[model samples]
Target: MMATIVKGGSFVIDSSSWESIMTPEDLSEEQTLIAEAAEHFIENEVLPHDGELEKLDYKLTVQLIRKAGELGLLGVDVPEKYGGLGLDKVSSTLISEKLAKGSSFALSVGAHVGIGTLPIVFFGTPEQKRKYLPDLADGSKIAAYCLTEPSSGSDALGARATAKLSDDRTHYVLNGAKQFITNAGFADVFIVYAKIDGKHFSAFIVERTMEGVSIGPEEKKMGIKGSSTCPLILDQVKVPVDNLLGEPGKGHVIAFNILNIGRFKLGAGCVGAAKDAISLSAAYANERTQFGKPISSFPLIGEKLADMNIATFVLESMVYRTAGLIDAVLQNIDHGSDAAGVQSAKGIAEYALECSINKVFGTEALDFVADEGVQIHGGYGFIQEYKIERIYRDSRINRIFEGTNEINRLLITGTLLKKAMKGELPLMEHAQSVQESMLEPTEQSDTDERFAQEKRLLATAKQIFLLVGGQAVQTYGLELEEQQEVLARLSDMMIAIYAMESALLRAEKITAKSGEKRGELASIMTSVYVHDTFASIERAAKQSVAAMASGDLLSLQLSVLRKWTRHTPPDTIRLKRQVAEKVKAAERYVVV
Candidate 1:
C-alpha cells in the first residue's frame, strides 16, 4: 500500500505528482478481471431481465441479489474469515461501477453490497460478523440501508425515531419509520438508525422477522423504479441487545462514516451509468439518420457526445483517484482486530470532502449525459421503448440519493472549513499564502511544456479559490457557517479545482507512460474540461466575493480574481470536435 502522501482535504494547497495517484489506467489485471466479470454478469443476467425488474418484481430482485452473492460479488469488501473476498477499495469500486450498466438493478445490488452489508463488514463485532456476514456474503440474506426518514432527509440527527430498552433488558424496542429504504421490499437484514430513548442517535441491526417489523408499499417513483424503495415501519420491533451496531451513543460516528463510504460507491456507480448512457446514445446517433446522413455525423450531435464524454472521463478519474486515497489508508489495517471498525471508519472518513465532491459531481454529470442521451435519441428518447428514457429517469434520483446534491454541496465546504478550524488541513494558511503572493511578481510559466496552458489555468483556479476563500474568512470569521451562499460557492470552486487537477494529473500520467502521441485523447479531454471548468470557477468566485462584500471591497476582490482569471482558455470547439471523433468512432467511452 502506498503511504498517504496527501492528507484528506489537503489537495487544495498540496502539490501532487502524476505518478503518485492511481487511475483506471493503473488497475491491476486482477482488479480489471473482477470489474469485467461484473460487467459480464450485468449484461448477461440483469439487463436481460430489465422488463421484469422494471415491473417491480420483488422475487426476481431477491434472486438476482443472491446470484450476485454466489459470484462473490457481494463479498468483495467483506473479510475472508467471515466468508468475504476482502478485496481492496479499487476492486469493490469497479464492481460497483460495472453493475450500474444494468440500470436500476445496480441500485438493488449497490444498496445491498454497499450501504446494506458494509456497515456490518466494517463495524460489526466478531459475533456479529460470524453470524451475519456469511449469510450476507452468500446471498441467503439480503440487506437494506435505513437512514433517511420522512421528516429528516438531510438532517440525519433530526430523526424522530426512538429506541428504548425493554423491561426485560434483553432487547430494545424500536419504534419509528425509515423512509426511501432501498431493498426494503425483500431485504432480510436492515441497518436502521434511530434515536436511543428519543435522544442519542444510534444504529441497529434490525432483522426482518422481528416482531412488529413491516414494510410499507413500494413507492411510485420517478426513477430507479426497479429498485424496491419502501418505508420501514418499526412498531415496537424488539431487536436483541447484541444487534446494536458499534456502540450505544456513538451511532452518529457509524452513520456519517458509512455515508462517506456510500458516497464513494455512489460516485463510481454514476460513472458506470454515464458510460452506459454515452454508449447507448452514440450507438443510436449512428443508426438514426437525418436528411441523408447519420446524426452521429452531425457536428451538433458530436458536440453533445464530446461534452458528455469529457465530463464522465474526469468524473471517472476523480472516483478512482479518491478510491486510491481510501485504499492507501485501509491497506495496513488488520481487519480481524477489534479496533478495525474504528480504524477503518477513520480511514474512510479522512476523505469525506472528496467523497461528497464525487457524489455531487458524478451524479450531476450522469444526469447531464442521460439528458443528452435522450435528446440525441430524439422522440425515441422519451418513449419507454427506448432505454435512454429509463436511464433519464434513474439519473434524477442520484442527486437526491446518499444525500441531496444541496446537502452534499454544503457538506463539501462545511467539512473543509471544519478541517481548517481543527488544523487538520492548512486551508487558512494556504489562503494567507495566496494573499501574500498576490503582491509578489508573478512567475512566467513555460508555455512549451506538455500542457502549459492547462497547468497555468489550473493553478490560477486554485489561487482564485484561495484568494476568495481568504477574503471570506477575513470578513466572516467564526460566523461563516451561516453564510451558506458563500460556503456553497466556495464548494463550487473547490469542486472545479479537484476535477481539473484529477483530469490533468491523469492525462500527465498517461502521457508519461504511453508517449505524447498516444496520450493525445486524454490530454485533449483534460484541456477541454479544464477550460470550461475554469470559466465556471471564475463565476463562482466572483459570485462568492460579491455576496460576501459589496462596493469597493468587492471591487478589490474582483480585481484579484480578474488577474487570476486572465489566462486564455484552449480552443474548446476544436478540442471537443477531436474528442467527438474518437467517441463517435468507438461508440463508447474509450478513454478507459
Candidate 2:
C-alpha cells in the first residue's frame, strides 16, 4: 500500500520515507564545479561594481549580466537546443545560491532568468523559443515579467489590463499598466498578462520597440535599489496575435506555474544570502572586542551566531531537498518533445506544497539572520558604510518578493487541502492514523539511539499537525479559508515539520557516511533545531486547537498535545555554545 501511494507522487506522510530523499551532501562533482564557477564570477565580476550597481547604473548592470551569460550562468535550466546549458534543477539552485552574495545584482539576474524568461521557455511556441531564447540565454536580450497591476496584486487574475483584437484579427491592442515591474527599465522583451475581450485572461509577448509601450520612472525603494523597478504602461500597444503565450484563456496556467518556480528559486537565493550573513556576522564577532575581550567570546553573541548558522543549515537542507525532487521528476521528461514545457510545469507543480513551504520558511529565516548580522556589527550595523547594513535592507524585500510571505503562508495549507480533496495526497488518511496512534498506549520506542529522541519528537510533531489540522477542517469545512489565523498556525506547524525533517535526514545521511567524529556538528545542529522547532510546533498546535475548540474539547485536545510533545529538552545553551565555538574558530559558517 505504501509503495502504491509512493508511486502516486503524493506528499510523504510517513517519516521513514524521508531518508530516501536526496540532500545537499549528494551533490555530484560536476554540480560542485558549476557552483564554484558561479562563486568565482560573483567574487570577481559583481562585487567590484557593487557601488555602481547600487547607484542604479543600468548600463553596468546590463554589462555584468552579459558577462554572466558569457559564462553560461543565465541558462542553467534552459535546454541545450535553445542555447542554454540545459542543467538539472540542483545546478540551477546552486547558481542561484552562489549569485545571492552579489546583493542587488543577484536580484537583477534572478528576475531576468526566472520570471522574465522562463514563461517563454516553458510556454512559448517553437518559433518563439527559436527567436528569443538564444538572445535571452546569452544575455544579448534582457527580459521582464509584467503581472501586477495597481488594482490587482495577489489577486493576479483580477488584472484590469485588457487586450482587444484588431479588425484583421492579426494583432492585440493592449491597454493598461503593470506596477513594480522588475527589469522593466531596460528589458528588450516583456511577458505581459492581460485579459482579452475583458474576460479571457491571457499572456502576450510584447517587445520594447512597440509604439505605445512606455516605462515609468524608476521608483526609489528602501532596498534592492540597484535593480531596475518601474511601472510599465501600455496604451493601445499592438502585439501580434502570434505573440500570445500558451493558450488563450489559459494565462493563469503560465502565471501560476512560473510563480511556482519563482517561489522555489527565491527560497534558494535566500539560503545563499543567509549563508553570507552567517559568515559576515561570525567574522565580525570574532574581531570586534567588548570589555577587553572578543565579542565572540560572550555567550550572548555566541548564541546569536549559533542560531544564525542553525537556521542556515536547515534552510540549505530544505532547498536542496526540494531541488532534488524537482530534478527527479524532470529527469523522465523528454526535453525535445513538444509537450516538454507543459510536462516540466507539471513536474514542478507536483511539489507546490513544498515549494510554498520553502518560500515562506527560507525568507523569514533570512530576515532573522540578517537582523542578527546587523546587530553583531554593533552601531556600525546602522550605517550604510557597513555591508551588513546593506544586507539588512536588501533582505527586507524577500519577504514580499515572489508573492508576499503572507500569501505564501496561506498557499501552503490551501494547496495541501486541495491535494487531499483530489486524492493526490493522503492527508486525511494520515490524520486518522495519527488519531489512532494517540488513542493507543504509549510504549518505549526502540530505535537508533543516536537520533532516537529526535526521531520520536519528529513523529510527535507530525501527530500534532494531524490533530490540529484535522480538527480545523472538520469544524470549518470549506469555510476554513476565513479562519486566517488558524490557517497560518497550521502553516507554521507544517513549516516546522518540514524544516525539522530535512535537518534530521541530512544529519543522519552525514553521520552514516562519516561517523560521529566528523558528523558531530551536524548531529548537534539537528538536535538543536528539532528541539526548538518541536516547542514552536507545540505552541502553534495548542493555540490552533484552542481557537477551534473550547471547554472540555479544548482541554482534551491540549492534554493529547502535551502527551505527544513530551520530550527531554536538550541543553540548547550548551549545544549553541558548542556550535558557536566552531563558527567562531572558523570565522564563518562551517557546518554546511
Candidate 3:
C-alpha cells in the first residue's frame, strides 16, 4: 500500500495504511479518561435537566453550560496557559461525541465549544486570547457564532452586515442582523462576521454588554427546542480595533476554516446521537412484545436493528479515523506561539474534504437510525413521552446545519476537483493510470489471507470513483463544475470509497492486534457495510455514466463497470444477523 505524509483529499488517489490511523480500539488511557469524564458530565449534570431544558429554559441551559466549564469539558481545545486543558484533537472529538447523549443540550454546548470560541482560540491575537479565552474555556461565558444572515445562508460572503472605522480610529461601528445564531439568547460574546465599509469581509468580537448589541426572541423550532436559536442585531455597536479577528480581508479564511472544524465536531455529535438511538431502540425491542413474543425475537425486527448497527459502526470508524489524522497535524503546532490560532486552522484545513464527508454521511446516517428507532417504538415513538421521539426530531436539523447536505455534497466533489487542478492531489494521474490498466487483462483474487476479499473490493471501488470522475471531467471539461447532478452522483461515489476503506482499515487493524475471534464482529460488520455500499457505489457510477454517454460509448463504459464490480458480495444476511445478536445482547451498538 502507498503510505506517506497523509494529504487532505488524497484518499481518492492513494491507498491508505491502517498502521498510522487511529481506531476506537487505539484509545489511550488519557483519552479514555477524557471520554469517561465527558460521559459523566452528560449523564449526571446534563440529562437530569432534560425536562427543563426541553421547556426552552435558556437560564438553565446557561447554567448547564457553566457546569460543563466547571467540569473542564469546555476547555479541551484551549491552551493550558489560558485556563484550558488543551487536549489533543481526539480528546475534543471524544468530548463532542459523549455530550451528544443529552440531545438539545449537545447543540448548545457544541455551538459554544466549536464555532463560538474557536475563532478566538484559532485566529485571535495574543491580547485577545489572553483577555477572552479564560472565561470561554471555563464556561463562565458563552459564545455564539454569527454568520448566517436572513438572506445569506449558503452564500455567506454575500453578507450585508457592515462595519466601519470610526473617527479618530478608536472603534468600528458594526451593524447587521445575523439570523439563526446558536446560543444567541445567553451568549456573553459573539464571533460576528461583517463586511468592512460594506466590502471587505471580516470577523469581530462583539461583547453582549457593548451598546447596540441585542438579541431577538428565540424562534420556535421543530426539534432541539432546548437549544437557543435567535437573531443577533448589531446596531451601531462599537468594537475596538484590537477586537478584530485575523486580518480584515482574510475573514473568509477564519470563517471557512472554522467551519471545517465545526463540520467535523458536528459529525462527532451525530455519532453519539446515533449510538443512543440504537441503544434505546434495542432496549425497547427486547422488552416490547407482539405476536406471542418479544419484538427482538422476530427476524424482521432484528434486520432493522442490524442495519442501524452497521451504518453507525461505519460512521464511528470514519469519525475516529479523521480525529486521529487531525491529532497528527496538531502535534506539530506550538500553542504558545502568537500564530498558534492561525496554525491550528491551517493544520485542520488539510482534512476539509474528510470533515465535509463526515458531516454529510454522519448526519444522514443518524437521521436514518433515528427514523428507524421511531418505527421500532411504534405509536409510542411519535408521542412526546418517548425519548426516541425527541431524538427523531433533533436528528432532522443536522442535515441542514454546518452546511446543508446538498451544499456539502457539492463542496465534496468541488474541493477534490480544485485540488486536482492545483496539483495538491494526484487524482488526475491516478485516473489516467486506472484507465490504462483497464486495457490490460483482468486478474482474479482467491487468496485465503484475512481481509483479502475486502481489500480487493475496496481497491475496485476507488478505481470506479476515479473512472466516473474522470469521464465526467472529460465530457464537461470546464463546464463539469456547473453540472450539479453529475457532481452529486460523483460525490456519492467518493463518499462510498472513503467509508468502505475507513471501515476496512479499522477492522483489519483490530484483527491484527487482537486475535481473529476478538475482532470477528468488527470484521463481519465491515464486510456487510462494504458489500452493501459497493453496490451503491456501482449504481452512482452507472447513473453518472448513463448521463454522460450513449450508444457504443455507453456500452463500452458499462463493460468496464462490470469488470470493476464483478467481485462476489459476501452473505450480508448471515453477517447482519450476527451483528444484530451482538447488539441485542449488549442492548446497544457494539464492536469487538
**Global lDDT of each candidate:** 0.89, 0.89, 0.91
List of clashing residue pairs for candidate 3: 122-341
Candidate 3, which segments miss by more than 4 Å at Cα? 1-4
lDDT of 2 by residue, 75-169 (tens): 98778888998899999999999999999999999999999999988998899998999999999999999999999988999999999999999
Cα-based lDDT at residue 549, candidate 1: 84
Residue 456 lDDT (model 2): 86
Task: Write down the lDDT that model 2 would get.
Answer: 0.89
**C-alpha lDDT of candidate 3 relative to the true structure:** 0.91
Q: For every candidate structure, what is the RMSD over all alpha carbons to the true structure, in angstroms?
A: 1.3, 2.0, 1.6
Candidate 1 achieves a global lDDT of 0.89
Question: lDDT-based ranking, best first?
Answer: 3, 1, 2
**Candidate 2: misplaced stretches above 4 Å?**
1-12, 16-19, 444-448
Error in Å for residue 74 of model 1? 0.2
Question: Cα lDDT for residue 455, model 2?
Answer: 85
Cα TM-score of candidate 1: 0.98
